[model samples]
Structures are given as C-alpha cells and as structure tokens.
Target: MLELRPNCECCGRDLPPASVEAMICTFECTFCADCVAGPLGGVRPNCGGEFVRRPVRPAAALARHPASTVRVFNPAGCGQAEAAR
Candidate 1:
C-alpha cells in the first residue's frame, strides 16, 4: 500500500490525500509538482528515479487507509538537487 505521504519532501508543502500536485518516485518519495519541475527536474534526489503523479486515494477509502502523517522534508537536499541539475 502506498503511504500517500502528506507533504512535499523537497519544499515541505502540504499535500493532502487528494492533492493533484503530489508526485512520487518508485520508492514513494513525495514532492510537489512545482518542486519536481523546478529544483528536482523530475528526478528524485534520494533515488535516481523519475517521478509520476501520486494517485489520490478515494475519500471513503482514506478513512480506512489513512494517509501518512509523517512528513519528509529536506531543504538542503532540495538545494543539492538544484545544483545537480
């Protein structure tokens, strides 16, 4: 099951369960679309993998399978990603 992470790993932006802006790598490293297109350049910083849009869990299903509350933020990593780009 996808963790459906709650925020952008790079920017720390809030990404609720249904946000269209959420993008994730195969390892489920979450980031916002802006971060992916900008600093990340569509590549995951932690894993050298491309990103894809994160699926929005159905509203009803979210109740049973809650989105993760834990956030993964790495401002320094985002800076490194920009430099690598």
Candidate 2:
C-alpha cells in the first residue's frame, strides 16, 4: 500500500486524503496542483518523473484502510545532487 503522503515536500502544503488537488508521480511522489501548474511548471519532481492525481480512498473503507497523518517522503534534488558528483 502507498504511504500516500500528505504534503508537497517542496512547499510543505497540506494534501488531505480526499483532496482533488493531489498530484503524484509513478512513485507516488505527491504534489499540489499549485506547485505543478504554477512555479514547478509540470516538471518531474525529485524522483525524476512526472506526476498524476492521487486516488481517493473511499470513505466506506475508512476504518479498514485508515487515513494517515504521517507524511512519508524526502524532498527532491537530494539524490540527484549526490548522483551528479
């Protein structure tokens, strides 16, 4: 199961489970619409991949698959910077 992170690592913006604003890459690197559409300009994140919208976990299954308050991710460029050297 994806850790389904709650914020954009760059901006530290909240991305709630049901949020329509959630964007993710194949690795499920989460970002907000604002980040991609505005400053980031649809650039692939630290994972070196494009992003897509995160799926909403159904409310009926809420208890069965509870929402996470914990954010699971590292910022972009950390690995890329190291790889460059």
The C-alpha local distance difference test score for the whole of candidate 2 amounts to 0.69
Query: What tens-digit string does per-residue lDDT give for candidate 1 at 1-85?
Result: 9999999988799999999999999999899999999987777777789999999999999999999999888877886667775
Candidate 1 TM-score over all chains jointly: 0.92
Candidate 2 TM-score over all chains jointly: 0.72
Model 1 collision count: 0
User: In model 1, what are the clashing residue pairs, if there are any?
Assistant: none
- What is the Cα-based lDDT of residue 5 in candidate 2? 81
RMSD of each: 1.1, 4.3
Best by lDDT: 1
Candidate 2 local lDDT, 11-72, one digit each (tens): 67898888889888787777788876755556563555676788888877765877667775
